[model samples]
Target chain A: MAASMLKVAVGSRAYSSGIRDVLWKLGRLNHVAIAVPEMEKARSFYRDVLGAQVSEPVALAEHGVLTVFVELGNTKLELLEPLGPESPIRGFLQKHRDGGMHHICIEVDHLPDAIQQLRQRQIRTLSPEARIGAHGKPVIFLHPKDCGGVLVELEEA
Target chain B: MAASMLKVAVGSRAYSSGIRDVLWKLGRLNHVAIAVPEMEKARSFYRDVLGAQVSEPVALAEHGVLTVFVELGNTKLELLEPLGPESPIRGFLQKHRDGGMHHICIEVDHLPDAIQQLRQRQIRTLSPEARIGAHGKPVIFLHPKDCGGVLVELEEA
Candidate 1:
């Protein structure tokens, strides 16, 4: 019985250690934001067709855009459209030639600390300072050219 | 004084409602997985260069691939490489032309119920049945064609 117990203990230890290593590598997923020409049409596909729950639309006057949030399993899909001329979404649509993935936002525990770390490493940031996001959270954009063409957003949740 | 008091009460209500809406949109992020050609090269960029914490590589023999998890701010970046001849990542790499975003995984409260809901809606899934994922959690994959060319994974944690 003792020998059998020892064997079980060793097997369990091996499994747990492997899992721990994987967990160490994983962080949390932020929000996936998609740029669209029309917010209502995008919502129809994401909400009606895909069965994602829609949150009330928010209009950010300062940013010159309107956004609708779709609550997925455990993440939020943000659909953004330009409110008028000179909106960022308008520029994105013109550059990409179609509505697609715009950027990936990642939540950080500390906004200042994260920004400092990135700055120290000579990473280029799109915004010099954090700005108020759609949800009123402080957020900053990282230049895609520096991150292998992947636009990244660091947010304080 | 009575009129002023009434105005303050109404203002407070509006403020509270706005705050509630923002909090509701801030959901828990699960993980973002990226398809790469070589796991070692991905690790060098994400881990050594980006200073992201990493986990030991794990080989999923059945899936014909190896995966390494990298911890970012509040989310994990999963790097995948094809292992055997039957691996799907190889095809994904070829189609994409370079390592880019692969699939976004969202955590759900229930796996069976979500799968049933998707099935009833005539949505096609990669796997007919849910399988255990890296963390011993049930996970199912949704076909990209059904979701507008975006492959999604629903994980029960």
Candidate 2:
């Protein structure tokens, strides 16, 4: 894990980490999520037109989403559809009728530590606590306002 | 390659392969592009804050944007900042303010054939001809309306 600490380039005051908190490291991008108005159409487009291996739709009722995974060689594209009236995606779709890119999910080594460290750096999260994500892992969403207008989800690896 | 296919699950009528036109395939996702209002801050956030290996900013004068790459091991996140008033990113930033997810680039084995086939399927493109992308590859932007409100870029591999 010392290699993780060494990743902070030399002479960088941006981190201010004389403490060397190597407890967590951000990992590979898990998926780029797109909220689609039509789930089956999006699934067929990626699987058949794009010729990518796509997974069957999984309903994450707890997450208020129906997800279909489109497997790219390096990463994945998650197509999400609103499951219920109260789904967050429903509001997003109302604003963007044709649907649009929703958010991005990246893997993190430690969720709790990352959250604490991010908050210290003035990054606000959408929720007060971590919740189980679509992948059934501890996940928390950083506020898009804090993340340069992009909704970012950090999931435990 | 035939192996590029065989990924399509059975019972997909999307391709309409009565003529068996398998001339091109969509490959890996190239990158997810995000237009940021502030380049230096966005660069530092991904690098020092997220602890990712980030690339130096590259100015694309022809493209009218400055680009910084955040390498996520498996893929990349492209942070773009507008270079001039005429830049397309300028418009994006004006709308998003803090910055937002722009477009996703996907690789294709053959660009021309994919464009033609996509046109046949009623997929509208922003331009009739492919242009040189930031990576110096032939790329075309698919119309967002046709793609469920997602601006998709197809780059030739």
Give the best candidate by lDDT.
2
DockQ for every model comes to 0.12, 0.39
Classify candidate 2 by CAPRI docking class.
Answer: acceptable
Candidate 2, residue A41: CA error in Å?
2.0
Candidate 1 lDDT at B55 equals 66
Most TM-score-accurate candidate: 2
Give me candidate 2's TM-score against the actual structure: 0.87
Alpha-carbon runs more than 4 Å astray in model 2: A1-20, B1-20
lDDT of 1 by residue, B21-46 (tens): 11112224467777777677666555
In model 1 chain B, where is the ten-residue run with the lowest total lDDT? B1-10
What lDDT tens digits, residue by residue, belong to model 2 across residues B55-141? Answer: 778899888999987877777799999997789888878889999999999999999999988887788999879999988899999
* Model 2 steric clash pairs: none
Which is the leading candidate under DockQ?
Answer: 2
List candidate 1 segments past 4 Å from native.
A1-30, A36-38, A41-53, A61-64, A72-75, A85-87, A90-100, A109-113, A127-130, B1-29, B44-52, B72-75, B95-98, B109-113, B127-138
Q: How much TM-score does chain B earn in each model?
A: 0.78, 0.87
lDDT of 2 at A112: 98
